[model samples]
Target: MAERYGVVPTRRQRLPLVLGVLVSLVLLAWLLWAAWSHSTPAVAGGLTSYDVVSSHQVRVVVDVSRQDGDPVTCTVSAQAEDHVVVGEDDVTFPAGPARTVQTTMTLRTEREATSVAVTDCRAGSGGPGARAPGR
Candidate 1:
């Protein structure tokens, strides 16, 4: 032999490297899937304003963003000064051809409320994709 360039890796020595590569590939695939699944939500909304109409009524204005034509249901709740839930209602609407919609809901409460909000929103008339609360 003239001059050996470099020693070839033996099968035994390369086994761990191959196994590590396989394990890393598997982990990377799993991470990609997890990230993709949670990248976007179906429904989201927020309370724009609220008005205390009377001792037993509240008017709430909200802005909702969602996929077009996806029927979404949201829960609006009225709370008293001590953060007690004094009224609640389920409001459902379709985004139609728009991605955002502004709505107003009037709730009759059992007592006076200091604040009103959209607590949760979900996609589809068939239930929901996922619940995003406190939006």
Candidate 2:
């Protein structure tokens, strides 16, 4: 009988195919690790206390005690009555297992404020504050 149009792959061909798949997997894993490392926070901390020091400025202090390398970049924002008042700011410091960072926010209005929300606070990972995954 005549041979089939497409023959099965021999052992030599299968060996190369397996090796190629393994190499691809290793490369993919490495890429994933690099991305994760880059995104992780270089410093660990959280907002501890915030107070209005004056009519036009407010003082904010954060406590960071979990990180081990590099100073954390802090970003602070303030909002009054659901409207954003102060924009973001960046603060850097030396690497510390535990440390406090303080920043002052200048307000646009001196009138008594009802409520304020401060957000976009983050360290490391680049930028003033840590951004969401898609942001």
Best by TM-score: 1
lDDT of 2 at 48: 62
- Best lDDT among the predictions, by candidate number: 1
- Cα lDDT for residue 96, model 2? 51
lDDT of 2 by residue, 1-135 (tens): 238567777999899899999999999999999999877745455566667655555555655543455555555555555564644444454455544444433333344343344444445555544432212
In model 2, the Cα lDDT at residue 111 comes to 43
Each candidate structure's TM-score, on Cα atoms with residue i matched to residue i, is 0.72, 0.49
Q: Which residues of candidate 1, in runs, are more than 4 Å off?
A: 1-13, 32-39, 126-135
State the weakest 10-residue window (summed lDDT) of model 2: 126-135
Clashing pairs in 1: none
Residue 75's lDDT within candidate 2 is 52
